[model samples]
Target: MSINCRTRAQRRNQVPLRIVALRFDFETSPQKIEQQLITFLRELRWKARGFDPADLEAAREADDWSDELLACSPSRHDSDKIRRRAQALADRRLRASGMAHLDKDAREKLRGLSDGVRVVQLPSAHRADEIAATLHDEMPWMAQATTLAWHAMRESVRSGAPALHLPPMLLDGPPGIGKSYWARRLAQLIGTPSEMIDAANEPAGFAVAGSQRGWATAQPGRPVELFLRERVGNPIMVIDEIDKVGDVLSNKGVNFALSNALLPLLEPLSAKAWSCPYFRVTFDMRWISWILTSNNRR
Candidate 1:
């Protein structure tokens, strides 16, 4: 092959992960590849090893998707243990929905998360320094907030966390100074998915803690759904206009301010076992980085 051709082929080899079917090669015969997969699966453990292509019609009639999980999980997470955990959760969701079999929409909705929650590789000191310098240049006015994020990022790395986890940060300053923007940029550098919630729109705080299943508008919290969509365990969440989160009361006379909703999630122990009101499932949300922004320290 020419130099360019060789380089391209090498890159392609690395592009695909070491997952189920990806282990096969063009050079290997089908019989040999099948044997290789069997041996590999024998060692790996879990359901994929037992998936028989010969039973395709039977599996199709039954409407199962376990075999296909092998095809997509390599990009989701690297740990087989985590993959199993995610698989269990996905199975529960499917069973609870009372679906007779799996379909495209179900697969798409739970795609990344059904695979696993990926713990992103922490940033190195050099990378951290680069991000700090960039943030400083872009939003010089939020230096203190920037410093806290920088320190937290470094501490998480030192503490040997699987992913970059920053402590919940409350940034207080005048509006229009790019505090939320800075938080988002930091998430980008750290390679975590992020979401921005305008507290002004969420008086009841259900957007953060999720609502009871009995409620007509019930659904999983942003953090849970974000994890499912992005497959990242440590996603950045920016709560903009936190001071505007009203002290709304329900008919029963209970306050549901966003700040109250955040207490359980902010507490390390409580967050580790947070139960979603909508899904009725416990989730470990401690690793999520929360950045709450406000116009003033009210």
Candidate 2:
């Protein structure tokens, strides 16, 4: 084969992550080539060992498009190039980590449970089923609560239709029933991490003091606001004990100060782009999925 063809073939071999050339003959059987490739990938512990032929073809085509884009435009962040690079890196890392040996059935099980989250609007039945499946290996009542919250969010997402109107979730349930655990586990099943905040402990102070009267006054940090700074766009943020939120425990003299502090997050009108009163900076919470849990239904 020509040097260019040989180089291309070597690159293809390297796509499965082991950085070495194979000892196959020019007349090697196709089946044997496949078997050897699979064995090599398995020995290296590649996570994408079972990638479908179609997916591989798509990836290859994407790489071709990315190359063309690079040749024509030469922008580093070009969408095609970025996506292709991301896929290549993901393939390399998965294989290098040897996640490929895990049971395909287990991966498939997680996929089925998480598939709905990928859709714009998940069906209520599917959402409920997903919640149930996530808690399948856990306690019953807790599972039921998770199912309820999941369905509520699903319904909220559905009602908004072409535009999303669900301002995340605020789950109110009794303590010791796995409220926070449900949020964390649900995030995990969806392949996203959950951020948890105890509403009872966040600092209450101005992000910055202003020149006007009451502007220099102390304010409180709202849990949701802080969570937005940390996990802005994820599918879950667990704000626990919302009832005890704010500085009401202090007799420093104030009424509804905590509610006022949280007003930007709780009020339908002010919450559109909630901000920290201290910093006077607004944050976007529309697309974020929040799961607020309180002992009291309020």
Candidate 3:
């Protein structure tokens, strides 16, 4: 393989003043070689465009075109192209309504949901610490968890990265442990909207993740509905009796399971690109904090 390096000024001027070039033959599979070439060309393009190499590497490793677009594009217009491409791919899979066909009600609902998907920006580390302290004081048993959560929040703030320190927490204990109460209390303390899903009664997973539009009685997912109603992105979602979630066979002859549906929402990467079954649009869902309570450890 051979690579050519050029000065930023030369790159800006579209000058081909190559500094150095090296060549090598690799004894690798054809597919591997093809992937390597593609990666090398992508890095070259990003560098030529004067984008941060680290950002390019991160986007490539994560397979996130949106991040890559943000790194390379200087204007929203350029980034929109990348976003549109991603949406097109998602549309191909789901065959959902396009943005052009979205009615006013659907657009308004989506706008409301988008507001709820964004992270709650904190002012400073001091405020984050204060919130943590208050949470610990209110729920003495969760002191350790609160401390860690605040530390993570402060670190994220300091580093100028999205706050993703707090992962979905599953509180497990016997009955009468105030598990549900604590979840609600935490949400109240954080000053965000909260919703409880009674998994024991609502066994169908579609209630949580939403049913596809083609299905009868289809509607937006619980989280989307909560966001639309509360008009907040970072709501506290508490799933009660999660272990008691029952399986159900859908009208499409597919088995729907709560745990399976919740998996993407619980993970940061997948949640960042979550596609709503109803709206059929992909949106970030990493802002929502999840709390699950189960009587049995399993």
Candidate 4:
């Protein structure tokens, strides 16, 4: 009899057998393993109480708005006014697009953007410490920089002011040393979205400060774009390869340099009342965290 059958017969007959060593080999093909893993995941998903479908749909709609807001050049767009109008229009469009079930209060808030100026609510000092710790964990080599930044952020937060002004950071280092990466990671750690501009390729300095409304294809500047997309005044704006920004000569035989365009924006006083060419409105942009990354060591 086969060993398996003998073992079963002995068990059924209530018989005691001599002690013996037994060995068994188990094997699974790659395909079978993959299938088992997939089954396990599906079972887990079925057991978990996942996100509500309505909430998921709302998040998708918000994501779509964010993407669209980031893609357009806001040359002539106004700051709060234009953004409010745009948001109202978007809310209408969303309603027309079968989201009639959206909360009435939310719709009213979008419409209310047109009536009042909204200030960004700064996070607490405790939150800033959490962000700093996360940054240190992500990039241990940047401990000094992160610590200083955290101190600044914490101080700003502790002041209990509605607006928080953060100093602009100019990161000078060689290529591949993670300067740009640090900026991006910092934004993520702070729980804010970031927008990166390649100054080397976009030679038009107007793109940073925005074109005048009289000019064709004029839009709002990069700062306005961040505020509109993220609905916050303090988003991180990263200008990569700032050292390589090129100068362009206009039709009037005037040379426009990127540094010249950035000078006013970088200054705290000037940035406090930065004018938007599109809406022709002055916006307080001191809260924005500007990060300029360059390959130049100097």
Best by lDDT: 1
Total clashes in model 4, counting residue pairs 3 or more apart in sequence or in different chains: 9
Each model's TM-score?
0.64, 0.41, 0.59, 0.58
lDDT winner, 1 or 3:
1
Question: What ranges in model 3 sit over 4 Å off?
Answer: 1-97, 101-104, 111-118, 162-165, 251-253
After superposition, candidate 4 runs with Cα above 4 Å error: 1-123
Model 1 scores a C-alpha lDDT of 0.64
The digit string of per-residue lDDT tens for model 4 on 113-205 reads 232223333356777778788888888877767877788778877886554445888887778878778887776655455778888877677
Q: Which scores greater on TM-score, model 1 or model 4?
A: 1
Model 3 earns a TM-score of 0.59
Question: lDDT of all the models against the reference?
Answer: 0.64, 0.44, 0.63, 0.58
Query: Candidate 4's error at 208, in angstroms?
Result: 1.3
lDDT of 2 by residue, 69-154 (tens): 33333234444454465555545544443333333442232222221221123334465466556676675666556566556656
Cα shift from native, residue 125, model 1 (Å) = 1.6
- Name the lDDT value of residue 209 in candidate 3: 92
Q: Estimate the Cα RMSD of every predicted model relative to the unseen true structure.
A: 14.3, 20.7, 19.2, 26.4
Q: How much RMSD separates candidate 1 from the native structure?
A: 14.3
Best by TM-score: 1
lDDT of 4 at 7: 22
Ten residues in sequence with the least summed lDDT for candidate 2: 1-10
Clashes of 1: 0
Clashing pairs in 3: 1-24, 116-232, 116-233
